[model samples]
Target: MKKILLLFILISSVSFGQKKLDKLLNKFNKNNVPYISVDSLASTKAILLDAREEKEFKVSHLEDAILVGFDHFEIAQTIAKLPTDKNAKIVVYCSLGIRSEIVADKLIKEGYTNVFNLYGGIFEWKNKDHQVIDTLGSNTEKVHTFNKDWSKWLKKGKKIY
Candidate 1:
């Protein structure tokens, strides 16, 4: 009975936390671009794009994720990196998905039909135990949280500023 109670409590807390995150994302994102969950992304072969700054990306990123940068994002440069097929699946992510929405929108404007914003971004990816790689392509738990304020979202992994 004690074990069941503990399990229920743990499940409840996790669910509550996810609800809070959903509320936060809803507040910031325009919802113009569709969001793909971390689990959903894991089973797919999309082109992963990191929308964070170069410094943040160096700390850790999803495997095969290309850094496109958010602050100085250039459509021309980004397009050059993308495949000629506009329908190709592309997923953009940042610390917590806010910045990625902006980047995803840009891709849509540029005629990419299959662009998706990572629902909870890198923070969620690491929170879900997905592997992240450092600059050397070695798996690491360290993730750039963007700032101390945003670091709270990361439930697992070594938080890097």
Candidate 2:
């Protein structure tokens, strides 16, 4: 009985401690940061970034989103291609919400004033029935489901090929 109780407490603490990402997401949502749907952002002056790898992004991505993987060693070099306005609204997203938050934090640290993490990442955006365009400007009309491939190794977004 003691062992069972200890295991439960351990699990709870780990989950509770890991809520950092969730907290950041909640704060962003509560603050009412401007969220640009892929379509809306495509129409607006805002910058949409896919914090995923080049190969994965090549598979499919919002037409206007710049591909910049968070784990890449030289992220700042990649960031240089973006708009120079530090206050310009930038939306960062990946397969799931984890890496996006990290990237958003880094952007803020790098002097970006208005950085936002897409709460649900691309999955949530697609799940909301939003359209994800392909590289060639054709409406692919399908979610970039990360599915089990991501679930296995990435342990984040789902895989949908």
Candidate 3:
């Protein structure tokens, strides 16, 4: 009986762990990320972070978003550069929302008061017909298409570039 209960708990935890992110995402404004929209993001003074690789980031990214590239070194530098306000609002996103989710958890653990993970990352934003500005070598907003066939679930509506 104890073994059965343990197994059930394990299964429940595994099944529901991701849902925590859903709630976290909803705690902020909406439209772009799950919890926060682009307009809301613009108005709420949240810091935007793009966790993609440097090469991919060079292709395109959200306007005014800081690039951290999901590496330990990059994350450290990014954190160091952040303002001293522990309660500042932060929005982190990566391709398909995986890395951003992980980063959000890390931020929370590190004493950040308000953190949000963009639910679908830039992929969903473009699909929703939202604009994405790029800030890198060239300052041009490009359509952030998920360049893979399996990404169909991410693209729901119009495309942007």
| lDDT of each candidate versus the true structure | 0.95, 0.64, 0.64
The global Cα lDDT (0 to 1) of model 2 is 0.64
List the pairs of residues colliding in candidate 1: none
Ranking by TM-score: 1, 3, 2
Evaluate model 3: give its lDDT: 0.64
Model 3 CA deviation exceeding 4 Å by range: 1-34, 37-39, 71-74, 135-150, 154-161
Query: For candidate 1, lDDT tens digit of each residue in 1-161?
Result: 99999999999998999999989999998999999999999999999999999999999999999999999999999999999999999999999999999999999999999999999999999999999999999999999999999999999999988
Comparing 1 and 3 on lDDT, the stronger one? 1
Q: Could you say which candidate leads in lDDT?
A: 1
Worst 10 residues of 2 by lDDT: 150-159
Global Cα RMSD, each model:
0.8, 9.6, 11.7
Off by over 4 Å in 2: 1-45, 142-144, 147-161
Clashes of each: 0, 5, 9
lDDT of 1: 0.95
Q: Model 2 over residues 43-141: C-alpha lDDT tens digits?
A: 556677788776667666666888878668355675687678888888888865656667777777788888876655776555445656666766554
- Ranked candidates, highest lDDT first: 1, 3, 2
Q: Write the per-residue lDDT of candidate 3 for residues 42-112, one digit (tens) a residue.
A: 55677888877776576667777888877653556778867789788899877657667677777777888
